[model samples]
Target: MSPATQAMQREDTQNPAMLWIANGQQLWHTAPKDSNGKSCAACHSDAKESMRSKAAGFPRFSAPAGKVITLSQQINQCRSNAQQAAALPQESAELLALEAYVALQSRGLPVSPSRDPQTRQAAARGQKLFTTRIGQLNLSCAQCHDNNAGKRLAGALIPQGHANAYPIYRLEWQGVGSLQRRLRNCMSGVRAEVPPYGAPDLVDLEAYLAQRAQGMPMETPGVRP
Candidate 1:
């Protein structure tokens, strides 16, 4: 990103993602409509205290789900199991807002994906997917993110493809988006078959990314051009 874009992210007032974060804060304290469901705050209490460093350890095994899941998935699980509410749809404004709000609590903390067997296995599958060629272009994620990182592609810089900064305010999208959205964009760019949102494959890839980005500081609500 350019200096100006970086500055936009660093300053909360200038960051567009702050809007989502604010909405998320409101939702955290707001009860579900048409139901006796409790607000997120009712169960978790103060997010700053209860959710601190929580985002760092995502893409972990969920005993209830019996699989590895992302932060967003976990949030939905909490809503369903604890709040007795319906799970929010992927990439929905409300969901993204909640995710952004939760992720914000872990900003500047190190990425710390679980080392459990199931998570590790998912990461292994993701690693294989990362290296395997696919799509009309016959390209792999490693080709651009690993081999050609820092190189120019269609007038844009090819980043190292880290998952540290997410739920970012992408100028291209004109809104906050999740890592899975970004992955879908890449698949489309490569002319590959795009998977549906919340697919296990995407979650597995996220687990791999989390492991790859381990120890990197979280940069939720990041801005990207």
Candidate 2:
């Protein structure tokens, strides 16, 4: 990481994304009225300790869901099942804020998933998707993100397209966004049919990314140019 980028992540005051973190903190304690006033805090106190490294092991298989799910999806399911609350709408500000908060807790942690056997099929599909060429441009993720990483495309430098740092604050977007948003943007860049948010392919790709980024530190709410 650049010195400037490292410094940016170190402080809350300089990071505008901290607003979402604060909102997430508030929501953490917001009593769930539907489930006898229970709340996240009531179950898990102080996310800093309770959720340490939790986001690193994501895209986990849930027998109940019958497929892999991301940390964001897991959060929504938890609210519905544990608190008897309606699930948060996908890509909603509240959901993003909450996701940012949880993912932040895993900062500097390694990407590690249980890799349940049930999820192998999805992961395999994701591997194929990452390497396959598609769309009008017929560009695969590896073409730029792997094959020519660190080289210039047009006027911009291409990184290895790791998902280690996500829910990032992009200078272009002028706000924080989840990794799926970034993936969708990349899909558009390749002129591929952008996957709808929460699509199985997106989830699978996320799983592949988690494995691809294994041992890399989680840098949630990251800043990007």
Candidate 3:
């Protein structure tokens, strides 16, 4: 295998985010009284059976929302509607674990984000967002991750903005987070005020990232520096 791919593999094995995934597995089977006394397993059966190869497609256009939605958003929706559980705050351990578990189901599947009309439009918007300068730094995501990918910035190698692997354990964050959350971190890095989770702009950006990684295999539960 090429060095970069080999390095990425090594990173995954060493990722601490796997611990959160393990936690999520435990949570999934734990019954909650507030959830109508139901466990996630009740409706989903086995996580492998119900969710296998499912997370490979994300940032999907939700007809109900009239916009693209990330995998994390969908998990929250499921918690509210299917599991009868209260929606946890975004970036919480409960949400992260659930997302990690779902993402793991699609491990090794190719990212197949939609090409539907809505998604296409969202992707277009996202591309613009990627290149547009935002925040106090007046820098775009491409400024580092794209234009200077593989180069060093303050002692870190800039990745090529690949979102195929997500629900990753980031050493910096010291926890698991979604690609969208990472996008927000970039916005913050540039001193830009981040939009709310599930915000249209962020959703579009996710759609664009997933579409860019069209044929890339899903590496959910990835570990990143």
lDDT of each: 0.93, 0.84, 0.81
User: Which residue pairs does candidate 2 place in steric collision?
Assistant: none
Root-mean-square deviation of every model? 0.8, 1.7, 2.6
Candidate 1 vs candidate 3: the lDDT winner is: 1
| Sort by TM-score, top down from the best | 1, 2, 3
Q: Alpha-carbon error at 137 in model 2, in Å?
A: 0.4
TM-score of each: 0.98, 0.93, 0.89
**lDDT (10s digit) by residue, model 1, range 92-175:** 999999999999999999999899999999999999889889899999999999999999999999999998989999999999
Which residue pairs collide in model 1, if any? none
Best by TM-score: 1
Clashing pairs in 3: none
Which runs in model 2 stand beyond 4 Å of their true positions? Answer: 1-3, 32-36
Tell me how far the alpha carbon of residue 146 in candidate 3 is from the true structure, in angstroms, after superposition.
Answer: 2.0
**Cα lDDT of model 2 by residue, 1-225, tens digit:** 456766777676887788888888888888655665778888888999999998898888987777899888998888987777888888788788888898899998888855787566677778899999988999999898889998887887788988977777777888888889988988998788997989999998888888888899888878777
